[model samples]
Target: MQRWLTYQKERFPLLAHFPLVLLTSWCVLSFASPEPVKIGTLLLVTLLILGLFFQLRVFDEFKDYEEDKTYRPYRAVPRGLITLRELRNVGLFVAGFQLTATYSWNYPSLTLLLVCWIYMVLMGKEFFNPEWLKKQPLLYMLSHLPIVALIQMYAASFVWDLDFPPATWVLALVSLSGGALLEYGRKIRPPEKEEHGVQTYSALWGIPRALMTWFLAGSFGVFALGFAGGGWWVLSVFYGLMFPYALISALRKSALWLKFVELFSAIWIVLMYLALARFP
Candidate 1:
């Protein structure tokens, strides 16, 4: 039990993720329904989203086991803090809980959950061609990013009919862009910090280009929020304030600044969801 708690702190960090998951679930529920969200529904949806992210982390551990073992031995799974078998058992338990919870609380959403599971299974397998996909980093990231959108759609399903209007997909786009922003931001590193066998956007695309891609991904999310009739001005103001600093940091190749950028990516997503919840 102690080891599992340690593993979560080192790997998942529920303290960092819970609020974001709750806000994201609330945003989707707000956008999908005109009615006020019951506390029961909000709690169930937040747990479901949290469980989904935890399962994704578990899948990543399994998928990247060999790579992490070789290049990142300090990680929890690599350092013997937790065994893969134990993690797999926990993941299975979470999956079962997600299924049963959705079935009991919102049966219609079960289909959407299954769809997300199917896509996640494909992602875990790297679409069955890991070698080819690895060679195309952009494609690999793009392929996996849809999982974020699908998760958002599933959240929406809790409050919306399966046949929701086309406009609702804009929220999915916002979610996808948020995922992209985080993916690009976290993988960026100063040139000096690049590690062999570790795939970082900064290493692959150079610091400037990688920063540009991250910025553009974030800009896309802001535009998506505006198009969806959310309070995009809030994000736009935040973006205007942050970009120059991020650009200067990247140009200076400050590792500390890179960490700031990574942190900002998470904050940006939370704010984006908050803005969405403002939808009239």
Candidate 2:
């Protein structure tokens, strides 16, 4: 049990995931209500989202098992620290916990949960055509990212009592863009560090192009946040200056700089949600 707990903490890093999960739920819930949400509602959504993310991680482990064995055998699962059976059991437990929590909400909210739950299952299987999406990275990413929007919408549904409004699309788009930015950032590794069978964005699209796409996604995130009437200006200027510098540094092929850029992209998402919670 201790070993499994350690593995989960190392993979998910609660320091980062908890803040982002809590704020993400708060940000979306705030979109439905001008004032603060109830403590019970806020915590329930946070737990559901966190469990969903954990399942996503478990899905990745199963999906990438063979690939990880070939490209990065030292990883926890690839190195035999834990088996897929164990991980799948954990994933099922988390999903059950999420369902139990959602049962406390209204029936309409359960429908919203079902939407996300179904979407997540499809994502885990890569829509039943892994090879097809592996050949189309952008489409693959776009397909997978809507879950972020769906989960955000699910959070909003609880606040609005099943009468969630279309205005919440702004929050959805913000979540999508922020997710895309982080997705792009992590997959943008330098060429030398790139391992065979690892389909990094840097390898798929040249380093410069990948960096440009990441920055573009971040810009869209800024626009979405500002459009949602949240504190977006701080992020706009922050990313506007930060991205170009990160791009230039990435061009110089500094691995350290690229990693820092990844960290910064995560912080950008965290801060945006924090600001939304505090000011929205």
Candidate 3:
């Protein structure tokens, strides 16, 4: 049991992860509902989001089991800290719980949950061509990241009380950019951490370009928040003060950026949603 928990923390890190997921869900609540969000709705949606994130991590495990065994034997799964079969069973269990919780309150909520589930399954399959898609960074990232938007929609529906419109769907992009911030930033590892087969943005685009990409993505995230009129003061100000340093770090691969890189993504996300909830 302890080993399984440790395995999850290695990938998911609940303490660092929960607040960000909760706040993102809260932001969606604020966006979709002007009235006070029901406490029950908040609890359910937050749990669902967290569960789905874990499920996503498990999918990565399943998808990469063989790769880890070959090139990344030190990883938890490959090292036998946990087994592929165990993670698969847990993934199925989490998905089942997600489905059950989605419908327990409102049956219609199942629609969005299923949408997310189906997308997750397709993602697990890597759209049937993992190797080919891995070569295409643009397509690979764009394909996988839309799940963030889907999760946002699911969160909004918990409080929307009306049919979701396609027009308002663009608002989800604000948070989508938040996801990008994490995606790019997390993959920007240092020289020693870079793996041969693993695709780090820094490896693909080179360090300077990768950091530039992170900076730009962070800028767009703030822009999206500001454009949507959600006051992400911390995000705005952090980006404001760190813009120069972020560039320097990217350009120089300095210790400042490396130290900040690990937590910066989570901080941006937490502040982003806090701003949404504050403004909403």
For all candidates in order, the CA lDDT equals: 0.86, 0.78, 0.77
Q: How many clashes in each candidate?
A: 0, 0, 0
- How do all models score by TM-score? 0.95, 0.91, 0.91
How would you encode candidate 2's per-residue C-alpha lDDT over 1-280 as one tens digit per residue? Answer: 8768777766777777887788788777776788768888888889888888888889889888888999889788988888899989988888788777778675577887888889988998999999988899999999989988888877887877677566666666778878897788779887667888888888888877887878777677667667667766576556667777666865686686676668778777776666555545
Q: In angstroms, how far off is 113's CA in candidate 1?
A: 0.6
lDDT of 1 by residue, 151-221 (tens): 99999998774877776767877899899988986798877788888999988888888888888887777
Pull out the clashing pairs in model 2.
none
- Following a full C-alpha superposition, what root-mean-square deviation does model 3 have from the true structure? 2.2
Between candidates 1 and 2, the one scoring higher on TM-score is 1
Best-matching candidate per lDDT? 1
Give lDDT: candidate 2, residue 278: 51
Residues 40-158 of candidate 3 have per-residue lDDT tens digits of 88888889899988889889888988988899998899999988788889888888888887778766778888889899999999999988998899678889888988888877877
Candidate 3 global TM-score: 0.91
lDDT measured at residue 83 in model 1 versus the true structure, 0 to 100: 88
- Candidate 3 weakest ten by summed lDDT: 161-170
